[model samples]
Structures are given as C-alpha cells and as structure tokens.
Target: MKVEIWSDVMCPFCYIGKNNFEKALEDLPFKDEIEVEWKSFQLDPTLDPDQTKTTFEYFREKKGFPEAQAKQMIGQVSQMGIKSGIKFNFDKALITNTFSAHKLLHLAKKYKKANEMEEALFIAHFIEGKNVGHIDTLVAIAGSLGINTDEARQVLTSEEFNDEVKNDFSEAGSHGISGVPFFILNGKYSVSGAQPVEFFANALQQTYEETVIPLKNISGGDNSCDADGCSI
Candidate 1:
C-alpha cells in the first residue's frame, strides 16, 4: 500500500501528524510493503522569507491574532507534540516561506531521504530556530544526510525541482485539500489532521487487508449443470 502525505514543514500539526503516523507504521503488520511519499503544501506562499518578522509577529500582523492568543495556540500545540514524543519550541521558531524548502525536499525524495529531510527541517525550524528558508542552512542539512553538499547546493542555486514542488501543490488542490497533514492511503482512503495513533493503525490495516484479499466474485464461473445440462 502507498500512503501520500501533504504537509508543510512549518505546520506544528504536520510534525505531530508525522509522529503519529510513524508510530502506527511501527506496529503495522505489512509495514515492509508500505510506501510513504511526502508531498509539499505551503500554508502561506506569499510570505517573504527574507523579512525580519518573527513567527509570532507574522501571526499577529498577518493573521490578525493577538500575541496572547498566538502564544496560547502554540502552547496547546506544544502539549500535543509532547504526547507524540516531539519537542516544539515555538518561541524561537522562524517565520519564512517554505517554497525553497519544498524544492529541496523534492531533491531529497530522489535520493530516498525525503523523510529524513522532513524531520530535520521540522526540528531546525521549530526546535533549533534555524532559518530553513535559507539556502545555506538547507545545504548543510542535506550534507548531514550524506547527500553531496555541492550537488545539493547546485540544485538550490538553480531552478531545479521547482516544477516537482508545484506539481505536488497542483495535485493537492485537485484533491480539494486546503490544510496540512492530509494523508491519502492507496489514493482511496483519506485521513485529515493529526488523528490518534489508533486511527492511523486502523487505516493501514484496512487498506492492507482489502488490497490483499480479493472481493467475492459473484459473476458466473465455468459453465456447469445446475438442475439441467448446461448449454454452450
């Protein structure tokens, strides 16, 4: 079974969703056959990455939320992260556009390190307060993953993988997905938001079983006599 996740690195719930789904996969009976593909979704694509505004400031100015309310929201999300074994430090988080980060993610997917890239990017922005939108920071992150630093930088410096990122966005739009942490299982079953671990486990189990077991064939089989001789 294939699971496709559409999320943004800057979304607090997206990281939490990642943890929850991963926990479910750990216990999945057919985990070895499951393929996970992380796609990109920008919550605010028009935001300027080079702006001096902080995440809290963006919330206050752009979203029109008061400082107290923003802090409360972050606190609540942080509590959710704690349950998922994730440490979120929103106080130090940066506010920047994630388009470049998404492009880099596409590159990581090519090398089969997209999951690692996503996790590292999340930690960098939320916990370490690193500038994930910066090219240098992304190149360093890729290097840590054993990806060729020069090659990664070359991709970042150029317009590489931009179409791939855009394609993911287009696909998300077509799926009517307007939020982060949206998960699609086998392109059939979809679970939105950071649901509990049990929800993910059940979805995984159901998809696997339905795919492996064929539905009853109610159509006619080989011709046979039924109360009379069958005619060709």
Candidate 2:
C-alpha cells in the first residue's frame, strides 16, 4: 500500500508519528511491497522570515502560552520522544520558517534519499539543535547525504522547487488537512496524527489485502520501494 504523510519538519508529533509508522512498516507482512511518501505542510506559513527568535520564543509569542506552560508541553513531548528513541531539545530548538526546508526535501526526493534526509532533518532541528532553516546548514546536511553539494547549494540559494513546495501545501488543503502528521493510505484509508504503530499496520494490512495479489514467489532476495500507491 501507499502512504502519504503531510507534516512540518519542526513538528514534534510528526517526528514521533514518523518513527512509529516506520516501526510498523518494519514488521509488516508486506513490508517490501509498501511505499511511503512524505508531503510538505507548513505549520506556520505567515511566520516572519527575518525573525531571529528561538523556537521557544516563537511558541510563547505566537501560541500565546506562558513560559512555564510551553516548557511543560515541551517536557511532555520530550518524554514521549525518549520512548520512541528520538531525542528532542525543546529548549534549544528555534522555530524558523520551514518553507526552505520543504523545498530541500523535494530535491532530496530526486536523489532517492528523501526518506533518509527527512528523518535526519527532523532530528537536526528538533533534537540536535541545528539550524535546518539556514542555507549553509541545509547544504551541508544535503551534501552529507551523498547529494551533489553544489547542486544542493544552488537549489537552496535559488528559487528551485518553490512551486512544488506550494503544491504540496495546496494538496494538503485540498484533502481537507488542517493539522499535520496526516496520513492517507493507498489513496483510500486516511489516518491523522502520530497514532500508535498498531493503527498504521492495521490500516496498511487491511487496505493491501483488499487489492493486492500476494506474490508467493519469495526468493528471499527481492527489494522494491515503489511510489505507485505511496505519496512521499
């Protein structure tokens, strides 16, 4: 089955949802046959690009939450992240504009390493305290992923993939998505949020069983990650 996920890189729940969904996929009966897509969704499109504020400051100001409450919310998320083996430094994170980040993700997809880059970028921003929204940092990260550094730099510096990024956001709204971590399985079943692994597995198995003819030809040596039904 194909799975399309709409999420912002800065979203803590999206990260958690990603990890859980991966775990579910790892154990799926048709793991090799399933495909996954990560679509772009901006959590805050109107955020000031020139704002040099930290993530905590942005949350406190934009969300209108007190400092203590924001920290508490972050702390709870951190605990949840620990359970999923993803670390989050809510104190050190900065909530910058993620539009550029989304554009880079599209470029990564071309190199066939979008999934790996997505996970790395999420951890860099939310856990490693890296400035993912920064051009130099993104270029470096993309380079580290075996992508052409110069090409990555040009893409980040130029207006490359800007429209594609917008289309992703537009498609999310077209699908009635208001919040992130939204999952559309096989262009049919839809699930939202970073739900438990069981939820994703059940949805995937149920959908696939309905349409696919299970190939019993298992040579114990076949790997396929197709995007036909997937929506990354």
Candidate 3:
C-alpha cells in the first residue's frame, strides 16, 4: 500500500500528524509493504524567505489575532504537540517561506529519503526553530540524511526540483486540500488534519483491505477441502 501525505513543514499539525500516522503504521501487519511519500504544500507561499518574523508575530499581525489570544492558541497547539510526542516551540519558530524546503524535499526524493527529509525539516521548523528556508540549513539537513552535500547545495542554489514542488502544490489544489497534514491512503481514502492514532490505524486498515484484491474461489466448495472433511 502507498500513502501520500500533503504537508507543510511549518504547519504544527503536520508534524503531529506525522507522529500519529507513524504510530499507527507500527502495529500494522502489512507495515513492511507500505510505501510513504511526502508531498509539499505551502501555507504561505507569498511569505518572504529572507524575512525573520516569528510565528507569534505572524499570528498577531497576519491572522489578526490579539497578543493574548495568539499566545493562548499557540499554547494549545504546543499541548497538542506534546501529546504527539513533539516539542513545538512557537516562540522560537520563524515564519519563513517553505518553498525552498519543499524543493529540497523533492531532491531527497531522488535518494528515497523524502520521508526522512520531511521529518528533519519539521524538527528544524517546529522544534529547533532553525531557518528551514535557508540553503545552508537545508544542505546541512540533506547531509545528515546521507545525501551528498554538494548535490544538495547545487539543488538549493539552482532551480532544481522546483517543478516537482510546484507540481505537488498543483496536485494538492486538484485534490481540494486547503489544509496541512492531509493523507491519501492508496490514492483512494483521504484523511484530513492531525487525527488520533486510532483514526489513522482504522483508515490504514480499511484502505488496505479495500485496495488489496481478494483471491476468487473459482471452484467454490465443489473441490474444496475443509478442516473436518474433504469434498470429493
């Protein structure tokens, strides 16, 4: 089974969703047969990559939330992150464009390390508060994933994988996905938002059963043998 996740690194719920989805995958009998692909989606594509606005400031200024309300909302999200085994430091988070980070993810896809790259990007943004949009940070992340730093730098410095990232954006639009952490199981079932582990597990199980074709008993019981007796 293949699972495609449309996520944004800067989105707090995306990281939480990732953890929940992985936890669900852990107990699956067909976990080894599952393939996961990370697709990019930008919540603020117009944000300047060079800007150094904190997430709190973005919420207050851009989202029109009051200071206290913004802090309270962020606190709530932080609690959610904690529940998902993540430490989300919104105070340290910078609101920079994730387009470059998405491009780097496409580069990682070439090495079959996109999922690892996504996790690293999420940590950099939500936990470590690193500038994921910066080329230096992305190259460092790529190197950590066993991807060649030079190649990673070349991709970041140039327009490499730009189309892949844009295509992911287009695909997300086509799927009418306006939020992060959207999951498509086997290209059939869609699960939106950072749902609980049980929700993901149920979706995975259901999708697996629906996608996998059952063997047809052409002979029926005419020539079948039972545990108690054989049909002769």
Candidate 4:
C-alpha cells in the first residue's frame, strides 16, 4: 500500500502529523508493506528568502495574529510536540521561503533519501533554527544524508527540480488541499490534520479490509478423492 503525504517543513502540524502517523504505523499489522511518499506544499510561496524575521514575527505580521495569541498558539503546539517526543523551538525558527528547500526534497526523492531529507529539514527549521532557504545549509543537510554535496550545490545553484516542486503544488490544489500534513492512503482514504494514532490505524485497517480479497467457495464439488480410492 502507498501513502502520499502533502506537507510543508515550516508547518508545525506537519511535523506533528508525521510523528503521529508513524506512531500509528508501529502498531499496524501490515506496516512492513506500507510505502510513504512525501509531497511538497508551501504555506507561503510568496515569502522573501532574505527576510530576517523570526517565526514569531512572521505569524504576527503575515498571519495578522496578535503577539499574545501567537505565543499562546505556538505554546499549545509546543506542548503537543512534547507529548509526541519532539522538541520544538518555535521562537528561534527563521522565516524564509521554502521553494529551494522543496527543490532539494525532490532531489532527495530521486536518491531514495526523501524521508531523511524531510526529517532533517523539519529538525533544522523547528529545532535548530537553521535557514532552510539558504543553499549552504541545504547542502550540509543533504550531505548528512549521504547525498553528494557538490551535486546538491549544483542543483541549488540552478533551476533544477523547480518544476517538480511546482507540480506537487498543483497536484495539491487539484486535491483541494488548502493545508499541510494532509495524508492520502492508497489514493482511496483521506485523513486531514494531525489526528490521533488510532485514527490512522483505523484507516489502515479499513483500507486493508476493502482491498484484501476474501476467500469464498465459487463452486460445489460432487466427487472427492481419498488416499486409497476415488469417489464418484
């Protein structure tokens, strides 16, 4: 079975949903047969990469949320992360465009290191507060996952994987996906937001039931063969 997830690294719920979905897989009977493909979704594609504002500032200005509300909102998300065993340092996060970062993800997908790339990017942005839009930082992250740094730099320096990122965005639009961390299982079941682990597990179960062929008698047999003789 295949699971395609549309998410943005800058989206806090995406990371949380990822962990929750993973936790659900742990208890799933057919977990070994599952394939997860991460898709690109940018929350703000128009953002400037050279911006020096922090996550707090971005939420306050662009989102039109008051400073107190922003802190309270992130505070709630931070508690959720802690419960999921993830540490989020939202205050230190940098506000920058993830177009180039999404491009690297496409490159990573080519080398079968997409998951590693996604994890590293999320950690860098939410925990380590690294500027994911920068080429050097992306190269280092890609290098840590055994990706060729020079190749990564070359890709970043040019318009490589740009179309792939845009295509993902277009696909998301087709699916009516307006938010991040949206999961499509087997292209049949859709689960939105960071739901509980049980919800994902139930979806997996439902998919299995719907897809697995059941054993049934198609015909009646009138004759049988025994060990010593054949009955007619």
Model 2 C-alpha RMSD to native: 8.3
- Report clash pairs, candidate 2: 2-229, 37-231, 37-232, 38-232, 55-94, 55-95
Candidate 3, residues 148-183, lDDT tens digits: the string is 999999988888888899999899888877776778
Candidate 1 vs candidate 2: the TM-score winner is 1
Decoy 3 TM-score against native: 0.89
**Model 4 per-residue lDDT tens digits across residues 1-232:** 9889888888777888788889989988799999999999887877898665796787777777788987886787788789877999987899799899999999999999898898999999999999999999999999999999999999999999999999999998888777767778787767777766777788777776786443221112212111121122
Error in Å for residue 47 of model 1: 0.9
Q: How much lDDT does candidate 3 score?
A: 0.80
Clashing pairs in 4: none
TM, every model: 0.89, 0.88, 0.89, 0.89
* Model 1 misplaced regions, further than 4 Å: 211-232
Clash number for candidate 1: 0
Pairs that collide in candidate 1 are: none
Tens-digit per-residue lDDT, 118-154, candidate 2:
8988878887888888888898889889999899989
Q: How far is each candidate from the true structure, as Cα RMSD in Å?
A: 13.8, 8.3, 13.1, 15.3
Better of 2 and 3 by lDDT: 3
lDDT over C-alpha atoms for residue 146 of model 4: 92
| Positional deviation of residue 70's Cα in model 4 after best superposition, in angstroms | 0.8
Please give me the total number of clashing residue pairs in predicted model 4.
0
